[model samples]
Target: MPSIMIADRDPNERTGIGWLVSSCAIPYEKVLSAGTMAEVFQLMESQTPDVICLELDMVGKGQWDRLKLLVDQYRPTVLVTTAEATFERAMQGIELNARDLWVKPQTPEYIRRVLTRCCQDQSYRMQMSQETTGVTGRAGEVSYLDLFFPRPLHGRTYPIMLAQLEDPKHHPELLRFFEDYPFRDKPVLLPLGDVIVGVFPDDTHEPQTLFHQTGKRLLMDWEAMSDAPLFLVMYDSKEREQSLNEKYLDAIQALHIRFFKGYRQLTIVERQVNWTMIDPFLTPSEQRLWVDMLHGGDPEVLKQWMYRHFSYKEEPYPEPGLLRIRLTSILAQVRRYMKSHGLDNGDLEQEYHRVFETILYSPILYRIVAEMLLFIQRLMDLVQNQREEVRVDVIEQAIRYMERRFTDSGLRLEDVARHVDRSPAYFSTLLTQKQGTSFRQLLTSLRVKEAQRLLLETSLSVGEIAERSGFVNANYFSKIFKEKTGTTPRLLRNQKKR
Candidate 1:
């Protein structure tokens, strides 16, 4: 049985959810409801439900900060429900780590399915916790073990490395031997027998002793101490499936190692090998990819693998260019995926293009990564650094230029593009690529924003604001303004006055 909490402002909506849960016979021990953000947090503290279904629109302005705090503290699987499901709204939900999003007019069956999935997910997490002994322990105490499948051990057909350090024959004698050894607690140890393992002990105990003796032997054999290390790389979507399906896994497995699959991600285990011995298996392009993946941890063997693999290739230019091309293609694919899934606004496409351009032209791979990170950081720093460099600078400029000239009545995008020193077609493509919105939409938004500012910040009447903002007719402006803002300009002005 799962406990569920519903956070919706409408009384009818709360009642509707209550009835749905009851009809499903979900074995819900408690069904708590709240109509405001404050109530939601209060109820959350008191009830501590297994799941939280939040109404996206009902949340008041600036409530996301408090919502995120509650989410972090409780760690409940959140399901966001909203009447208006836009890419911006969906992205907000994703940022908050909401597990799923449901729109209004949802069928009872759909609601039941979502709740069931949430329950199943919770059960799976609990089961994994029991199996892995709660992965949230101190890093030192957490034993880092690597399962390596060097040359397909024992003719096992499955592509997995199952190495356990608990084997008695190899580890027991070593543990006993280390009982009186010095340097027991100063340094970490890498143990090797049939498998490789890195042990960091929590206490001055036998496990530490075993690690010292066994780690030395393993290092002597492989000439290195760390166990398998995994790296996660996020690339563009189209090439992602192909990259994952193609060289990404094969390259890591070429070292005869184990890896785990994740959504558009891979975790690779660290391998210990002589630099001179394994330098024959990587191309320059492959080397860059490996380095990119190794950013999370120091998998130096991967660098050695790259060096060895590319030793025979005399040409250096093609490899880096190829790597950049592959990365750019991946980024483009990711943008397409985001658009198709309605996960982001169209602006991502333009941002992706800019990132791709910057990365491709950069002299070094590390520099490219640094610049990309800085761009993302700038975009995220919207509250401060009011005019900071962002991935969307080009689009922002276009929007500003349009807003300044929109009152001209006969203002055209071509004229705007000329002012920006770009061709009309190129500017159009850029706008569409970055804004995800068409030229008409940009123009309309500029007018709407201006209308809103005038209504809220000035004493101008609605009709006057509409005319000054470039609408041919005041009535049409009022209609479009209401459509965009969900409030008539006159009403908005009245509210501002009060």
Candidate 2:
């Protein structure tokens, strides 16, 4: 008859879990409860339970080590419960070989479902062990022996390489790439969840060179089979005292650099590379420069800007997070340009947001940069078409006329309509329909933009600046500026000065 223990600080919780377990209909002959860590330890010492529902958050660090020892000793089916499911807590659960980590406030159905699955898993494992007592070996035996053992075969130090697929879903297929790879001394392939760690024999002459050569060949060949990219991190040799597990960990840590280096190639894991400090946000001056570049309508300059920032591989590289934030800042500028050109609609807007997400979440820096370039090029194409259309486009011609004469104190919708060879009311409707803003609103925006430029660049008086920005009354200009910019002209100028 199997027994289970429910360990929590609360009596009600222990009783509730016990009742839920009984309701699960599993053949648990005994249901034990422990309201404290010491009680948990005492119950374990008395007679180790087959299953333990442990509240890991209640266990102190010192008691945790002792509890882990007990767990390792008895090999109980542990279902860890915690107040918060953090990465650290999840890792601790993994160390205890926990069947699953359930966060607190779990529903009855979820707890019952988890309990049933874990109980069945325990039974299956026991059955397997009993049946396989006399069996010789099984698949992944090489992985077991190499990773678990403290030392490798004496006098033979094999090189370790860890391959991580670009897409985690394709990890299982990666094992096949190494298993059939034509190495002189075929490497022992080990599947480590989303990573495959291989230990290659150092038998051939210049084995280091040969290992690198084979890694390249495998990269090219694997891509032929699957479209997903692969990243390989290799260590030439391990320390005399280092075990294969340590080497595996080292390679895994080194694999993180792949975010900066990119995929579909081999990287020799030699030394630690630190990320240099960087300010991710663009300065006001830099923002203005980007606006000028976009207004200049040259995509090559933007392409150069992309390459200048991203293509450099000098150590130490800027942190990936910082670069991502910087990319988002640039994307904000691109978004404004899209909106200004009436491109932020339908598929173009969707593609813009897609590019935004890629900049935020894409694993590879090169991939992010490539996607950004493609988006910018697409926008540039649209801008070129807009430029050609401007020659015959009534709305475009009207907008250009407004841009030229916005500084004139007497400039109005009628003047722009006359320039574009259309009636004032008809052009006003067309402008509002195409630009998504009224004629008065659009003219105000143009004038305010000029005012901002003058305020920031020149040391002109408020009244003088208002006249230059096409406002007859300085007080009305101040009110309109405050309404449009959220600040007074003098205050904005003062902010710039400071």
Candidate 3:
């Protein structure tokens, strides 16, 4: 049984969570509760629980820092619970390496599930640690590789499937060996096969040796197929586990392992991947289309084939003109489609696949596809605002733009676009793209702001100021002005004079 701790500020919240945990009947040996960060620290000193549930907005401002300290010291699996569903908070939770995030007002089932998952994960980690310590006695002697399948195989026979994967021009060297060997596919060969069994490793190894040894083991295990190879595939990079399965390895191989280093290590697994679809040597535009398709979720196999044929790295093929423009335009359309649909970060990978599949075969739609992906990615980045200073700068730029030109008569999108050195359409798209609001809203805000300034600083009639501040019609201006100011412009002006 695992030990658990809950830290939250509200008494009712603490009671609610305590009751939920009890009701769920989770196997916790001891459950500790703390209302404040200080109490949490004190509780930690006494007992180190297997799991920690933190309220993101608990008690005070320095709670996160304290939480970090607790996490570092105890190294428990942490789950953050918060009422605020903001990107910043979400990112902070991510940065803290929290096991998961739970929204407040969570249902009993949801809480139960999260706790169970965390505990199970903790148990798995403990088991793996023990295994790594060589308690099972198979650490260095056995080789392991994970195999994943995107879809269920058509048949149960591994040999037939290996043959399907081995078409030399299509599959990699590992797959090709199975294709070239005929006797290895005999039914009699299948019965004697301890030759290829999937093994899961408890310990992590250096990439080169891991891949090399695992490959050698598969070939050695099967007698007739001495040259046959094995590989590991990782499904989602987000999994905390060290070794990836075989299916993910197939995907990576299909991508042709485009970017290679002395030893493959990724800083941020998502961004650092120079996916097979992206040709490093292609023109920016061509590269853009490939990148968009990659993010859009182009099939790993097809992308690998394309990389093999079209990638600039595979020299001697003449570069195609207009590839960049085509890719950019397509990406722009994708961006628009995503925006109108209200999709979020979780949807990005799936949507990328959907959008790319929609345009992959098209001959002239490359630019549109590339632009759309770039647009979507930029929007995602803006929405997430991973860096605090970046978010502040973007907000400040919009505020400053409004403040400087609130009183200008022709304060249309085109004017702002020109100031920003973008087309009106592009600027409008950018504003909606970045701020999640339209230009009209921003402009109206600016006008209403000036209305307040006039009411407070100068003795001008509401109508007089409304017309001067770029409101064409007085009545329409008053309606908007009053809606924004929370009172009629006339009353505001009168109140100021009095």
Candidate 4:
């Protein structure tokens, strides 16, 4: 006969949560609903519930302290809901000892699972407390959780497993997995900041192959629960001069090998980690080779080069930090290619920045390589498309060059002709023949159009706008502007204001 309370600002959300809770198999004697903080407090004061579901957004700043006090006093299993899935909200849940924090609009199945898990946890804790009332702990008796610090080893050795997430910042989230692990005799689960160390009992005598199989099973189970990659390093401690703490450190060092081996697979470390020496920076010759390949624009050749250098794995692997540095060297050449092709701005620039960050922070080499290959394919496609478009019309190419440099006050017919690989005289004659306008006339029209746009949109003075629009002489610019638009720059701006 457990009682539960559901609190939210919206009536629909409150009813939805109540329905989901009722649909769960756990039988509840009372299902209370509250739409305000005052109502929630009234319900809690009147009837002590076994569980509480609260929306954090509706809780005002003044109510936080009182709510936290009530929660600590009643000690109900609390599940908080939030509109924003941010770290601050999560920290608030941790402060109230909430079992879970659900973002708004969660699926019914997920909500049910969370509620069931919280209820189960509450029941288990109550049962354990009752069973250990008189036989809790004698003086000087050490608990298994104390194994994290320096302790007496007595020259004993035990099999240990170091479980770590690909990104160690998520170590707190990993604790839930060990809470309901299926092990018959649960091992001592120790959290050492970035990694979780499980120290098995001394009676364990599993073979190396069996230990590896168990590690794989645990990894598969974790993958089923979370998408983040987990690295589980197993080591059977042979009676050596090292303490349990030292063995744990050795396993942590072994995790670096995943930089080469990739993640989502169990690793069995038999000995110390060994890293070979390597020059992380590219040599002058390699830089030249990268430039040549980029210029060649052959995807097959670039693919072969990537596979040959990065995909081939050998013993005594290079240090991961150094390999990351070398990857940046390759990116340097790619950046130059992008700049040469005018791909250094807008979406292409953002894509390049993403690849740069992935190279620096991605946990596995295979993922970095995969992202780089995809970016390279996009770059090659864009380059080929630009080449085909330019080949279709030389006059279009000349016009594009002029459009890009029209803001430069010193730009002339020779510059556009050189960009399209034609002499000044030939280019001028071709321009008039195609567009029925002289080069100077076309350039002036482009500049005047830009000046008119600036007049309408910006607050700049007439002289400043004229200079920005590639007009050196203010008087000439004013005459041309009037001729083109039939109004002065100041008059146009004043008319728009009216």
Q: Judging by TM-score against the true structure, name the best candidate.
A: 4
- Local accuracy of candidate 3 as per-residue lDDT tens digits, 226-263: 33322222222323332333333433432222121111
lDDT of each candidate versus the true structure: 0.56, 0.79, 0.54, 0.80
lDDT tens digits, residue span 112-159, model 1: 888888877776765654454311224332233322322211211111
Clashes of 1: 19
Query: Each candidate: RMSD to true structure?
Result: 30.4, 23.2, 27.9, 20.6
Please provide the root mean square deviation of candidate 1 (C-alpha atoms, Å). 30.4
Ten residues in sequence with the least summed lDDT for candidate 3:
183-192
* TM-score of decoy 4: 0.49
Error of 3 at 482 (Å): 99
The CA root-mean-square deviation of candidate 2, after full C-alpha superposition on the true structure, stands at: 23.2
Clashing pairs for predicted structure model 2, backbone only = none
Alpha carbon lDDT at 466, candidate 3: 86
Q: List the candidate 1 regions with Cα displacement exceeding 4 Å.
A: 134-498
Q: Tell me, by lDDT, which candidate is best.
A: 4
Please report how far candidate 3 places residue 341 from its true position, in Å.
97
